[model samples]
Target: MNMSTKPENKFSEYLGNDEQGNMRLRLGTKFAAIYVEKGKDIYKETSKGLVKVTLEELVSKPWIRENFERERAFQRSKALAVGLQSSHIPLRERRAYKKRMGWVGAH
Candidate 1:
């Protein structure tokens, strides 16, 4: 397989709790969502109720996985901005400061 055509294995990164300790993903709109409880069990919201699902099944849908990944990235950026602001780091030095503090990939 060509490296350019190979899919990246980022499933684990998107399947965990956020900084806020919430293990949930909003599916497209707020009307639907997915929740993961302890032990990695997954559930999805439906017109009827929550339905159990497998991690492999969930991530197989490209759109669903893409949306989840996008959400996770947004959350991480928001958290990083908050952390830098709370630390009183200047905007100009945020890049250098994050690198120096070893937080660039600490996540």
Candidate 2:
């Protein structure tokens, strides 16, 4: 009858990157898509095709919540790295400069 069982491992499907090189998630039956709104709130595309679900609803699934936080941290790290690279100053000096400018600890 071809009845498919759920994946035991949460990360069984490696969805990989989309065309724009943004990493996508393997939402499975829990979700269809993840959307980040203003103020960093999260929304998930529900199975019934709902788009603007609450952050609480989104976080109900452990893997989805984990992935969301991981994605956010990765982006922040990338921004910091970019900022560090853009400046001609040395790494040590840049750290001090960014700290003084209130950009380092703020993010």
Candidate 3:
């Protein structure tokens, strides 16, 4: 008997494009991977299956919580950098602000 087999693609379904237009795929049955133009692709797993989810829903998984925390910290740091770069802020005051924010020597 000749058995015909089909190749299985792990990223089986093209769910849709994210807001940035990067393609999102369903990885197997339980997870989704979003391809980004820059940096690493983001992977999210959900028990809700193929249903579309918001950013909060995607990052709410316990296994990926650390990634969410890291993202939050990065956003905070970016905001601090922008605030410290204001022309009106003196270098001395910026240094004081950094120290008060516990960011001394963190750069």
Candidate 4:
């Protein structure tokens, strides 16, 4: 897996571009993610067969990003609390908290 494109640790979105209409994914973004809980195996069998998947997979047309929008969103969230905090608040709250935290581009 490419080190830069890999998820923070684990956990992925399994998504694709909105217009591509990838039947295998759910996200409108080009980036994707995959992860299992701290316990239990990440893989399980289903009608789709052995269910072989990985965190390295990009389900979209492959955003091919270097400091792409996904990273921008990540940075913006990091600059915000609701976005990066464990509280799971909405985007607005996160943005406000970012401003409070003095993140320059939080808006």
Candidate 5:
């Protein structure tokens, strides 16, 4: 990419937990409302329905956070490896990609 030239893509993304493991938070996209799981509750009932904790928290108790981290790291690398040009992906595609990438969307 060019150092001075701005990317045709409107925004970039990443995966990470907040200080309290909230959400990555975005703007003007489906993920704009995305959120990360937080708390020890394996499941919770929301207005939509019951939500289950991710595998990371589920296995973290018995084993180590390292296992989950490795899996997540691998997933991140896989997504990046696709080498999909963010700008070429188009807006609708980006929205759909994000929606598929996370489960935080309101049903």
Candidate 6:
């Protein structure tokens, strides 16, 4: 897409600085707000309360750090793949497509 047609990216929007200079990121609606302590430890605020995230897990590309932001983007035709999949897809249609594609059945 052209620069003029490109939508804004909110991935960094969630990254904010607290008065104490802590890093904060608000994940999806299902997930809780994530906070970084001294840029070393990561914490997630959940219904069960604050939970610590291991550095190993956080450093993993497919988890909270990279994957979280990549998977949450909604822009120019990208939303069709990321944001609207659940709402746009009907179970019956999905099953039919899967059956036609010879996938056997839903997992």
lDDT of each: 0.60, 0.58, 0.51, 0.41, 0.47, 0.57
Q: TM-score for model 2?
A: 0.44
Where is model 1 more than 4 Å wrong at Cα? 1-22, 28-41, 46-50, 54-60, 93-107
Ranking by lDDT: 1, 2, 6, 3, 5, 4
User: For residues 39-98, could you state the per-residue lDDT of candidate 2 as single tens digits?
Assistant: 344444456653554657755856665765676678779889999788788988877978
Q: Could you say which candidate leads in lDDT?
A: 1
Instruction: Note the residue pairs that clash in candidate 3.
Output: none
What TM-score goes with each of the models? 0.45, 0.44, 0.34, 0.20, 0.24, 0.36
- Candidate 4 segments whose C-alpha is farther than 4 A from its true place: 1-87, 105-107
Expressed as tens digits, the lDDT of each residue in 1-107 for candidate 1 is: 63342224232223567575656664443244555433445566577876787777766865655655576688789998889778866786878778789989565
The digit string of per-residue lDDT tens for model 5 on 1-107 reads 64433333423233455586543322223323222334533343346755665787557643223334454577678777676554477768778877888853735
Residue-by-residue lDDT tens digits, candidate 4, 11-70: 334333234331122222343332222122232235564354344543342442222345
Please list all clashing residue pairs in model 4, or write none if there are none. 12-33, 12-34, 13-33, 14-33
Worst 10 residues of 5 by lDDT: 25-34
lDDT of 4: 0.41
CA RMSD of each candidate after superposition: 9.9, 8.9, 13.1, 13.5, 18.0, 14.5
Alpha-carbon runs more than 4 Å astray in model 2 = 1-41, 46-49, 52-60, 95-107
Q: How close is candidate 6 to the true structure, as a TM-score?
A: 0.36
lDDT value, residue 37 of candidate 5:
36
Model 6 over residues 1-75: C-alpha lDDT tens digits?
Answer: 533322232223356557987656665433345555445556776678768887676766334665334433533
TM-score of 5: 0.24
On residues 73-94, what C-alpha lDDT tens digit does candidate 3 reach at each position?
6656987889868778799987
